[model samples]
Target: MQVSEFHLTAYSTALFSTWIFIEELGLLFDAGDGLSAGLLQKARKVKYVFVSHADRDHLAGLLQFQQLNGRADGPLIHYPADSGSFPALEAFSQRFDPHIRGEAWRGIRSGDALPIRDRITVDALRNDHITAPVEWAKSLSYRVWHKKWKLRREYLDLPGSEIKDLIAQRGRAAVSEEVATLMVGYSGDTPVEDYGRWDGAKLLIHEATFVRKEDQDRARNNRHSSLEEVLRMAAEIKIDQLVLSHFSSRYSAEEIDTTIRRYGREFRVTCPVYRLLPGQIHRDVLREEPVWSL
Candidate 1:
């Protein structure tokens, strides 16, 4: 079986993906430039697209992606329905409606499930921990699923239970189930508290803007997670593998690695820590190896 993978790109000091494979189909998250275009072409071979957030770094190359791929019947563009926060997405929808033809852009929120393929599910999570306005909070994060692969019997229906609980208690809901062989978490500017809610992710793809503890104040003020914060989250969740990215240009590759190693030692966790530098290309070797048995 050909292993599915996740590709990363740089845009606005953040990490973006050209495409991610769930089941046999490809889901395009955020699009960037540089190596992103090449990855997007590779992703087009698969079937669907899912835009996680509306930030420029996340959606910069989306228009170009649509233009290059042209139009073919597939899933409707899945994104947050909040028009106020995602103005660019709304404009893109109107401007490119002719060439890249799509069904209505389905608005999603925390708890919504989007079926990507048979048994594969994508559950939307709110990006509220950012301290941004509610309108801007529409930036959706996701948790994918493959029911048959779940080891715990209760885990199969946990998403629905969680969503129902959230809605009944919170009075609002937007979660869905899409078939997913892997559970990857994308934090488009999420804060530390948000990390607590994300449990059992095999690979946690998160942002780490600063490398030093001195920058902790700045990271908090900016409402972004620092390298330490990312590591802390990884330790808290006990994730099998942690991919730390969205680094600040101030730190060199060596510096980032050193910082990660220093903090990683304290946590005593064996999960490998990886960084995403500008223009860096990361292939999913883990998919080929299948190290995590759970």
Candidate 2:
């Protein structure tokens, strides 16, 4: 449906911390520094966390988050299977908080899909954010799908009584087909390569770490997307809304917004676009006035 339905509360900056809480789904993307302090009581609602990578900025707040919200059936933490940092941190969290124990940690790889809540599934996709082998699970992006069963096309025109009879004769599975709608797409930290990666996603939360292409290219140690690259792709894709985050501390809010508004129009991006300004917590991002739209 709409992002407001998810009630996204988030805080993100490129080099410091990043975390997005989807209130409706009980889902948290990333666990960067200040997650507990920023969300406070709201943090208790997070039952599942999907970490994109092992970068310190992406998962620096895991200990505090788990300590406060964890119970015997504690929250589940999912991370890239090949990322070494999470295992160590998991062990430390267990030893550090013996009383508040049982934070289940799962290492997931690309193409794996996990059901986080009823009728909702989160699927992982590998991205080129980190250089590694093809099978390595070093970095990832995620897609959340909301699934429902609809009457099969062949049965849609039939009478309701007949459909019920058919269902009684056969089964619900035989009468209906499963359909999934892309509710949200998350690009944790990645360069813009696949223009259609987020196509049909209703709400896309992506990282735009650099305002300039040159600046992003200069940092060869890791990969990141610039504002223009993301907006240009947004223009070409079919996302209902876009939320830009993980902005660099180097750019002022004015600079970030100005560039977003400028390229957004230049690329003819039609979707309502919102941004999480660096170092600030955005409560209900889509409810806020959009920075760009046509």
**True-structure lDDT of candidate 2:** 0.91
Model 2, 75-120: lDDT tens digits are 8999999999999998888788987767799999999999987888
Colliding pairs, model 2: none
Backbone clashes for every candidate come to 17, 0
- Estimate the TM-score of every prediction: 0.73, 0.96
Kindly list the per-residue Cα lDDT of model 1 for residues 1-294, writing each as its tens digit.
222244433233554333333324466554544424556546555355566666555656555665555454753567776635455665766676665655345677777887876776777777753455765436666766655532234434666777577557755423333334446666655655655556767666677777776776755556567788777767766566666656777777778777787778776656766656534565543433321122
The local lDDT score (0 to 100) that residue 20 gets in candidate 1 is 36
lDDT of each: 0.58, 0.91
Residue 157's lDDT within candidate 1 is 62
Q: List candidate 2 segments past 4 Å from native.
A: 1-3
Error of 2 at 155 (Å): 2.7
Worst 10 residues of 2 by lDDT: 1-10
- Error at 51, model 1, angstroms: 3.0
